[model samples]
Every structure is written in structure tokens, then in C-alpha cells.
Target chain A: MREQSRGPAFMRILYLEDNPLLAFHVEQMIEDLGYVSAGSLSSFAELKEKFQSLQFDAVLVDIDLVDGPTGPDAAAWLQKRGIPAIFVTGQAQVAARHHDISLGFIEKPISPSDFAEKVELFRSRSTGS
Target chain B: MPIVILLDRASKPELVRAELARSWPRARLIFYQRPVTAVELVSGVQSALLVRLRQRDVRDHIGQEMELRRELNHRVKNILASVTSIFEMTRRGATSLDAFTDDFRGRLRALEKVHSAVFHAAEGAVSIGDIATLTFEPYRLVGQERISFSGPLMNLGRESGTTLALCLHELTTNAIKYGALSQPEGRVTLRWSVIDGVQPELALEWKESEGPLVIEPARAGYGTRYVRSALAAVFGRLPTIAFEPDGLRCSAQGPLSRLSATDSSQPR
Candidate 1:
């Protein structure tokens, strides 16, 4: 296990969201929670390239990315790489489908507090605390 | 010449034939007993009124078939026109890659919903309930807790149903993107009623609340234009849209007499 820290943990996150307005809000929330956003991608191709080149502690994905197959597709790709991932989706049924592989789901228009809590949970798990 | 043939028993056949022969000398008269042999009679008189009746029946059947074929073709053409309009609207308005995919899917789903509703109604007149249910199902999956509906069980002709279904789709999509469905705390209410006895008019209201404060668009978008134009063509009246202080509201009204149904034409 990595060494645990009392302050915000240093972990890299890759986010995949298509909507600019929502993406902006989510990115701000991730920063406020004191986690590093390694890179945020809007398309499947970009997501794959970023995942292959860098090591991300966790990934936050939206199920309905306009150009890509879906959030599940990204999650499945990350799963193949043995990376932890969670879906932030508006569709309940889609989230349910990924229950086996995903860490959890965060509904859209994500609340700031809820985001922080999820980030902390992911960080603790990543460090094996 | 128009001729009448009556098949009855318990009457004098010879006397009736003699009276008919005396009444009109230019007319030919034939007699048959009870349980008449239709084939024998037909063979006996090649130019009999009964043969003419059979020919007329066949002609009427063919005419009705032609009329039905024409009506079906007309309906198919109208549906194609509506689909084309939606495609054109999406093609012209799509800007980015994401926008293009989302818009295309939304429009295609709208067409599918409309087609399903019409098919379920058996290509006849559909009910307002059918249109509402079909158009709202997709949105309900996303915003399950935010939407509610109330309306009488009323039927609309196929044309009216198609038009109203399209409008409902546009409204739902707008709500998903910019209005009530966008926020977790927001709610949308849909209600409908009828008015005016002679020429019955249907009115539908869509109200949204508790969402992000809405600002009226400086200019109407493609969706707004499509709704206005399509409803005008279908209803022969302009739809009313108001961006209220709380949220957005739209009302659409149209005459009910234009609806087509097999029975119960009460002029209202």
C-alpha cells in the first residue's frame, strides 16, 4: 500500500465528459477536492490515447458521450487496463448495467459535496487505506 | 336504368310476372319460385338485371379498393414529408461533432416514437394519451421523478396525432437540454382539456418549474421555428409560448372537428 497522508491525497484522475458546461463544473469540483486531473477527454479516441500513455489512479466517465459508443465503453477499456472507474450518468439503467465493474455512479448535475465525498472514497481505496 | 330485384316466398309468381309484363311493355319480366336456382336463372337470361347487379357489385368493390389504396399512399407521403423536415432541421442546425450526434439521435427517436404510436393505434385515429405516453417515455427514464401528466382520454385523427407527437418530442428535448429535466429539483406538468361545443377545440399546457432561471433566447432557435411552423400548418393557428418568471410554458390549441373516426360524428 502507498503511504497514507492526512491532507488531500495525490492521485491522478482522467475525466470523460462531452458537455462543456457540465464538464467545466465537474473539473472545478475535482480541483476543489485537492485531486489532480491528469487529463479530461471528450471523445473515445482521446480517452484511449490518454489512458495508454499515462497512469491514472481512477477515471470519471459520463455514459452518454456524444461521439463515443457510451460511458460503459470507456469503462470497459479502463477495466481491461486494471484501472478503477466510476460512471457519472443521467441514465439509471446504464449505470445498473456496469454495476459489476464500476466503483459507483454519480448522477448528472453532480453536487459539489457529493463529488468531494466520492473523490475521497476513491483516493482512500486507491492507496489501499 | 336502375332496377330493383326482390327475393321473397309465399307469393304468386305467375300473377306477378303477368302484371309486370302488362305494366311495362318495353321491360322484360322473369319469374322464379321459392329456393330459386341462381345459376340456372343467370344462364337463362344473359342480359338479366341480376347479372347487371353482379357486375355493379364487382365495380363497386374495385372502386372502394382504389380509394383505399389512394388514401394509404397519401398517408405514407405525409409521413415521409414530416421525416424529411426533421432531418433537414437537424442537418442545418448541427454545429459540433457532439451536437451533430445528439441532435440526429434525438430527431430519429422522435420519428420512431411517432411511428410506434401510429402503429399501435392501427394506423387509424390515435388518442392524446398515446401521443403523450410515447413521447414522454424516453425523458421519464432520465428524469423519472420530475415529470407528471394529466389529461382526459381523448382521440385524435392520424394527422393530428402525428403533428401533436412531433410537438411533444420537441418540448421534451428542450426540457431535457435547457428546462425542467436539466435539474434534479425541477418538475414538469402536462395537462389538456377541450372547449367550444360546436367546433370543439383542444388545449394542451406544458408547465415547468424549480429549474435554473430561464432567459428568453434573443432569437428563436431551429426547434422553436419548427414547432411554430409545423403546428401552424396542422392547426391553422399559432401556438402560444411564454417564458414566465418561474419557468417556460407553452399552450397549443386546435379544432377537433378535423379529426377522422369511423363513427360518432357529432359535429364537435
Candidate 2:
């Protein structure tokens, strides 16, 4: 659980992605969209271990991570900590069941425009403006 | 009302008659003794039961087929997503259209080779040895054997195999551009072994030598970072990459259970 936002003024997005190439691509995309990448972790266990030190305004989670299908549970855990999470996965039906915990879903084969629009939700929700 | 009553040969027929009379006072009852050839009756019942069983079997097969189709769809989508990611990353780094095209094509070929191997594999899984051979075969000089790999017969599940193949591709491309494979005299060796213990571990090493002097890059590139993250995802541990003056060495070890295709995947 995060105590307080130690993140910089700009939004720092983190990715919970097991696929290395995809993780790198998303990191670059975050920078391309003018945001800083906190980092990428492969598993929910790794996320839990590294949560404290990581500085990110929001997290993009994939359903099937290095660990099993723990994305929904991770999102629920993040919600409890008051952190925002959005699922980016091919398994939309599975993600649909856990919409209660997540902000929304970004289907796989991610379009840059779609990604940008969904990611904007996090900023708007956080700022509360 | 018409009623029919069947009784075993040994049954006391009077008792059943009286009971049926009490139950249906106005009915005309017909009584017949059990057939002496009981085998026909038993076989008829057995055939009826088997018909039901066959229907259930067909239903189960259909269910399994649907599940397999669903799984295949997920796999294809994931591969497409990986391709999308590769395209974006390659484009980001490319200085020109030619560079991007070459790099992206190389990566796609590597992906296709692995998928082919996995498709031909008996259980939709592949071995590290198979991956290494497929990845290096195209890059090998016609007359010279510059790349070599040897390991035990260990299989990787589909996802793990795909990741490893991609990592090997990145390594191969880099070696060709600047590492050992760049020079005619340079050599690369990949070796792996299983460390038997309470929990057996798979240990692997990739070393390049006899090439130009090695210098650590100021910042890690796509290949290095991809290898680190991909290996970590499969092995559940980070791999070490060292750029010694003589050559580059990448090494990793993790629980064999995690790497084995036969074992049910358990999240660590």
C-alpha cells in the first residue's frame, strides 16, 4: 500500500507487463505521450514487493502476467490503497468481471489513440477538476 | 385402463397380482413371466446405456474443441500484440526506413521460426536447443560455424519458448552488428546445464569471444533490456549481463520446475 504520493508533478505511469517487448514499447509510448515511466514489473508479487519505492500516478495492468491471472486481484489491492489501475489485456471478458476495481479496460493490439484516451481518464479522475 | 405386469421367473406372482389389484381396482391386468433368455434383455439395456455414453462422449469432445479454439484465439491475439509492440519499438529506434524494415523483418522471422517449431512440436512446446538452432541457423555463415549451443533435453511451454526465441533474436542481431558475429574469426558459445538439488535449477550462459574489444554501452538498448525483462519473466529471476573487455557474457539460473513445459505453471 502506498502512503502518499512521492511522485513528481508530471504523471508517472507504471506497467505491469510480462512481455518484455511490449513493456518496452509501452514505456516508450508513455514518454512519447509526455509522461514519465515509473518502471515495469513482470508479476503481481513483484508489484507487491516494489510498490513502496515506485512512484507512479497510475498503473496499466495485463491479465496474464509472469504470475498467473492475478491482474484483477492486483487492481483490487491497488484500489484499496487508493491507487488507480486500468487493465490492458486481450481477455476482455475476464476483465469485464472485475470492472468494479479497475478504472476501465484497454483491449490488446493497443491503438495509440485509444491508449491516449483511456490513459487520460486517470489524469482527470486524479485531478478531480 | 390396460395394465401389464412383468415378474421374474422366481418371483411369487400372487403377491404382485394382489398388490396391483389393490392399487388399480378397475384396471384389466395382464401378467407375463420373465423371459428365459435374459441375455437379450440385458444386452438391449446395455446398448441403450452405451448410446447415452456415446452421446456424452461427443458432447465432451465438442466442449474440449471449443476450449482449444478459445485458447488458440487468445494465443493469436497475444502474438499480434507482441508484433505491434515490436513495430512501435523498432520504428522509435530506426534512423531510416531501411534500418527499420531490416530490423523489423528480422524480428518477425525470428517469431515465425519459433511459432513453426512450436506448431510442429508434439505437445505445442519447444526445447531450448531447438530455439537456439532455429534462431542462429539463418545467421550462420555458409561455410563457417560461428554460433554453437548445447543443453539438456528440457522443454519450455509455448509462452516461455516464444519469449526466449525473441531474446535470442535480439542477441543474434546485436552479435551480427557489433559483437562476436561481426568478425569472421569471432565465436559465440551458448551452454546450459541442470543443477540437481532439492529444487533442480536450469543454468545457462551465453559468451562471445575472439571479436573486437568489448565496451559496455553508456545506456542499455532495446536488445539488452528486452533480454533482461524477458528472461526474468520466464525464470522468475533476473539474468546478469556483463561486457568484459574480451567479450560479452549473459548468464541466468532458475528453478527447473518453472522452466519445464510439463509442469503446471505456478505463480511465484
Q: Pick the candidate with the highest TM-score.
A: 2
lDDT of 1 by residue, B1-268 (tens): 3233344797776777777767776654455565767786665465576667877899999998886775565345434534544555566577887897888788678777776777677545788887888888887778796778888888876555766777778778888888877888888888988886878888878899998798898977666666665564344456788888688898778776643332121111
What are the per-residue Cα lDDT tens digits for candidate 2 across B122-219?
A: 77779999999898888766315888889888888877788888988898788888898888888889999999999999998889999899999997
Error of 2 at B35 (Å): 16
Candidate 2 C-alpha lDDT tens digits along A1-129: 132342333788889987776887887777777778876887788889878888887899999876677888888888889889999999989888888999898999999999998888887777663
Candidate 2: misplaced stretches above 4 Å?
A1-12, A34-38, A41-57, A66-68, B1-55, B261-268
CAPRI category for model 2: acceptable
Candidate 1 error regions (>4 Å): A1-129, B1-43, B46-58, B196-199, B258-268
Error of 1 at B140 (Å): 1.5
Minimum summed lDDT over a 10-residue window in model 2 chain B is located at B259-268
Q: After superposition, how far is residue A86 of candidate 2 from its true place, in Å?
A: 0.5
Instruction: Encode model 1's per-residue lDDT on A24-58: one tens digit a residue.
Output: 34554576678776645655656765555666778
Give the number of the best model, judged by DockQ: 2
